[model samples]
Target: MERDPPLVLDIDGTLTRPEGWGIDPRLFDPLLEWEAPVVIATGKAFPYPVALCHFAGIPELVVAENGGAVYTGDDVFFTADRDAAEAVAREYEAAGYSLGWGPEDTVNRWRETEIAVQHDQPVEPLREIADGYGLEVVDTGYAYHVKDPAPNKGDGVRTIAEHTNLDLEEAVAVGDSENDVSTFEVVGRSFAVGNADDAARGAADEVLEDVHADATLGVIERVRSA
Candidate 1:
């Protein structure tokens, strides 16, 4: 049998159920049984994807913090400076926003290379402040990430492909938000779920009718059949 192409996937809106934070139970077996590498690429903090990989019984290949961090099982790579992101967050806080998750925010506690501000917070102010520090603000739909402009999800995908000795031209990516646009651009084939934002739909090679984890499963089946 031919080997399946490597896959890069986003977490929240792409793999998890739309109604809640839980990972759709259907994804576990497919991930474990997948023939090629499965890379979890998300704007989430580093530890979150790492832990997910552990429990899912998959290899620990991850692109977390919106490409700010990459883990290839043996080594970890950081693309940006966390202090700069922290500075941006501090300035946003001084401007009278509460980081949107409250005083003891766990959302960004384990984050290493960037700060994730809650989506409910005003984005313009965060963007304005990030400009002064040479950082960029990206809305992942789940949150606004303040971080370095140099690295993105595409860069992380390239790094993973190189480390795994896989061909970029054969990789497949699936996602549902703006943060996913970079990965869509870098991979050979990309799918945007039905709930995907405009940016992701524009960047993807194909837009699926299914939403969330269901769409992801559909993509897997399509690839497997091909």
Candidate 2:
């Protein structure tokens, strides 16, 4: 029998239901029993995806902080310029805008390579400031991430693929936002969930009718039956 292709998934809006912030319970068993490696790629911090993989009983393959960090189970490495990201964050703060979280903000407490600002904050200004510092701002729908321009989900997935000895051209990826576009570009086939933003939909090879985790499950089913 032919082996299944490696799968790369986005966590937040792709794995979670539209009404909730957590992963849909429906995804647990399928992911846990998947024959091929599953990589969780997200704009979320490093620890979040790592923890999710740990509890899900999946390998700790991750592309976190929008590709600023990559964990290949045996080793972990960072690509984005943390110092540049921090400088942008500091400047953003000085411009009289709140980072959108409190002093004890858990949103960015563990973030190493990028800064995540709440969505409600003005994004244009953040983008301008990031550009001045030779950085970029990506809106993930949930938040605006200020980080290095070079490191993106594509780079992260490539790193994961390389370490796992998987063929990048045969991998499949699924996601629902702009941050996922990079991954879409790198994978052999990519799916954008029904609720995906325009950029993701445009980048993906196919746009699914189902939304969120349902779409992800559908993709898995499609791949399995192929």
Please name the candidate that would achieve the greatest TM-score relative to the true structure.
1
* Predicted candidate 2 versus true structure: per-residue lDDT over 1-226, tens digit per residue: 7777889999988999767478998898988988888999999989999999999999999999999999999889899657888888898899899898889989889998999999999999899999999888898989999988889999999998888876888889999999999999998999999989999999999999988998998999889734
Which tens-of-lDDT digit does each residue in 126-211 have in candidate 1? 99999999988988888999989888998998898878865778889999998899998888999999999999999999999999
Instruction: Output the worst ten-in-a-row residue range by lDDT, candidate 2.
Output: 17-26
Kindly report which residue stretches of model 2 are placed more than 4 angstroms away from their true locations once superposed. none
Q: Number of clashes in every candidate structure?
A: 0, 0
